[model samples]
Target: MKKIYNNLTFRVLTAILLGILLGHFAPSTAAQMKPLGDVFINMIKMVIAPIIFLTIVLGISNMGDLKKVGRVGGKALLYFEIITTIALVIGLVVANLIRPGDGVVTTGLATSGSAEAVSRYAQQSAEMDWMDFFMHVVPSNAVGAFAEGDILQVLVFSVLFGMGLTRMGSSGQSLIRAFDRLSKVFFNILNIVMKLAPIGAFGGMAYTIGTYGLAALLPLGKLMITVYVTMFLFIFVVLNLVLRYYKISLWQLLKYIKEELLIVLGTSSSESVLPLIMDKLEHLGCSRSVVGLVIPAGYSFNLDGTTIYLSMAVVFLAQVFQVDLTLAQELTILGILMVTSKGAAGVTGSGFIVLASTLTAVKVIPLEGLALLLGVDRFMSEARAITNTIGNTVATVWLARNENELDMKRLRQVFNKEEIDPLANYDY
Candidate 1:
């Protein structure tokens, strides 16, 4: 009994249930818990920049092979594109088949969402420039990137800085040692912050249930069901096949990351677990260089869940308004999402904005229908976040195997036994 109570996984799970009950019974109080989640997420975000900068720079300096860096990066980007496109197509196919919004009465669509909020997202979407996303990759202000916690910008700078370090040869040894110690220090900070996971989980869940309420799901229950069922199948069937081909067990990997999954489930923000996931993947046998390069890059370019949600949301809106989209239009959605979803992560409310951008480009679906998704969007975010985290983890492992950077012997040893604590090494 004492052991179970001391377990983070069990504690988080308990917090989630308590949150749900409190939200159901005392909504006003539950709503005030928002700060708990917000503060915890911010605490996690606080360490992200330094960790990414340090890890990538450390990995690259140790690697000391500029060609290998390029090859690894090229491979990760290619894999992200292929897998995310598949995710978009799968979402479209399922939404078409399920038709989640087939019979919804359109009369109440606008009434469900705040017009001000709808206008805000639409305006943001209109201002989104694909070129700007590309330009920001080479951040003009290095301090600003870290200040804003822009992972993509930091990654770009880290790669360049690391390349510079690699070229310095033996003279760089002292600096490399200093960076290594700094890395361990930040990791230890992460270990302490993680102890608050249950509080964060409780607060996040409570706020969602209190703000949105369980009743919000009923109006769009079919759509919610379709999204959840689709993501579940995608994880169990589609991703499982990827693992089976690579000779790894999906269930085992999921179990190993169970604590991280529960945290993400509660927070509805995968960023909550970004640094922790990168660390766990390295401990699970993926090469540090691959984990550092692929995971952070994957957060931006490889958001499988966002793509799936964007595709399905468009289809749902089309069905709601009874606007029949032709094959070419659907393909247009697939194309636009493949690019725009890359910009979806790392920003607040970016998913809806990205959806608006896709719909605006398609020039078919009614933009106002986006307001309809507002009610249940928060509820569905968990599915999106969980799938994205799992997808990135799998991508890192796959890339490691391809690059011969994975230690298969250690991987098997960890899985062959009970769940190994991913943070045992960082626990100071």
Candidate 2:
């Protein structure tokens, strides 16, 4: 049983089969099981702020040469900004052309009941302002930010502390070293916690499918399917282009991190894989500083999947309402998304929040469109998290290669090596 559970293929297949079977026949029990998924999500969320803080500050301060941190970070941020803009545009273009949400005449699309409950919750997401978004990044109390699980705030402080460490000469070096060691300890803890991913995956999937079954997807299946398909294409084709341009093998990278990817697929939160991916990227020859800085930053800005969803959903709403937009209006939407989407990493239900915020930013779409996506948004969150992980992972590698910071021999060894146990020396 342990062997079967450890086998990725076996675990995935078993989970899917069992989840479907339970979802089909015993839905009430499955609905009651949602707490398990909640627990897994909370566990993943629990680590994010601290993990980001420890990793970023330690990764930065440990560097013997801090100058390159700025150089690498600048380049990576630039790359992220460029690609995210393109992603927003692509989503808008495809959505406008396809018009998946147009003229649906969705009856029973009321702002009440289950959808209303979700919409009300989503409305809370809609209320956060852009100024508030910026203000939220500067922690009012550092400890409070961690308690609240605000990753961006933690990241902002980490960068400042790391730079201060760099400037403080030897005295700060000792503290930085301590943080570095602490970061390693946290990673080890995370590694141990992640061993339970299959269980979490099984529980989460069983609960979701068992409760919702295929019926819940009926009303919004087209939108969900469209988003999923577009996300898949973006990961394989668009991300592959970026990877191949850097001479990285997509297959090799995927193969090397199969366990981490599986955990992401199962848990549906990229945050769950942060530690594992950091370790994997380092093993793949990206400089630790590059991985440390770029990844956290990427989380906030380089959300390729979420960007795709925002673009798709916005136009989708417009089409649904049969509203026409001028070229200027579309560009304004793109610009607003560019601002609102960045630095939004680590917000719970942030994709929806960002989508709502983006819609608000453009000032053309009614907040009502957010109501349309309420029922199905939970299903799409996993895709957003997974694609964001892949995009950031690829971005880290590409940035490393661009800076000539990658250890080619180590990368080849890490990605190409095979062993009796896939987890061997692959510890996060």
Candidate 3:
């Protein structure tokens, strides 16, 4: 067990060091690493829809009642909305106070052409109106949606299908049981996929280093540092306070899931850890039903990290463009983000869209600010994924405790038991 921990640590540190060195000394070679990141992302993309579909179907079918799923889902979403709004507000307040983007005007930093790019992307995105967004959710063909790998649309279909199965009552229970069996199969597949994480991590890091190089990172280093510090504060301090209030040790829980967190950091895709998180929460003693419902919903709705990024990036863009935002207008961005950021779930680059939307709402920063950050966005994205996963994970365990679905004693035992035998039996 210690060897596994040691190896994982070594892989992570090695990736970071090699990436930094290559990014600094051989940027063109580093640029070639872009495909490595693509491969890693594709590996994750390959499984996300299947995992979401299976988990939801298994969770709902097990409940044996569609209405119960609705009730639980409604409550879970309500919690997500409330927490996500709080995250947005916190981000807005921080960005306004710090003004990380202020006094920053440099053509050489990266993507100086973003001003024009923003105009072009906006015109194109504006073509995607409310009707288009709503209609896209319906999916002209379910199979096609899966083939295309659209998560929200797939989720929409899964909910309806699961509900239909529930209404079938006894007959549906048979199939639901089947789905429960299949859920285990899919989870096994997920395990196989996760084995690729180290390579994914290496690819992701190499590409980041090769493209941006370490030196380019220096220009916006303050913004990166500020965002990271803010993320750490939220995870350790804010989350720690909440966990402490519950009489749980935050570090204990984190240590229990260190492997999962490292996988997320390497992949930069929370989806990569979806199955593992479900199992971990179960091992931690959250009821399967709550873990199934809340964690997936959190992916779509409770993206605290992405919310923070959108708020801060917009403020930074305004600073770069030298546009002054009134207090009222900044508040407006916070409110819009509270809504726009909700619908687009489990979508990579969704943050950029949210940022574009916020920029449009405020009419201060141009959409081009997205293009500016596009280069280093992947680098920051790993951090965003890490923070978002931590927030949602903590929220799940904490809420499960409140819902009486968690075993507090088990949580403490799992966390506090210092003698972890790597060869120790793990239920999964």
Q: Could you estimate the TM-score for every candidate?
A: 0.96, 0.89, 0.88
The parts of candidate 1 lying over 4 Å away from their true place are 109-113, 418-428
Q: Candidate 3 lDDT, tens digit per residue, 125-158?
A: 4553445567777778999878988777787888
In model 1, residue pairs whose N, Cα or C atoms come closer than 3 Å (at least 3 residues apart or on different chains), thus clashing, are none
Cα deviation at 33, candidate 1, in Å, is 0.5
RMSD of candidates 1 onward, in order: 2.7, 3.5, 3.5
Evaluated at residue 414, the lDDT of candidate 2 is 68
Query: Per-residue lDDT of 178-239 in model 2, one digit per residue for the tens?
Result: 77788777777777766566667767777767655667677777788888888887878888
Model 1 — TM-score against the truth?
0.96
Order of candidates by TM-score, top first?
Answer: 1, 2, 3
lDDT of 1: 0.89
Worst 10 residues of 3 by lDDT: 419-428
lDDT of each: 0.89, 0.75, 0.73
Q: Model 1, poorest ten-residue lDDT window?
A: 419-428
Model 2 ranges with Cα > 4 A deviation: 1-4, 109-126, 171-177, 361-366, 418-428
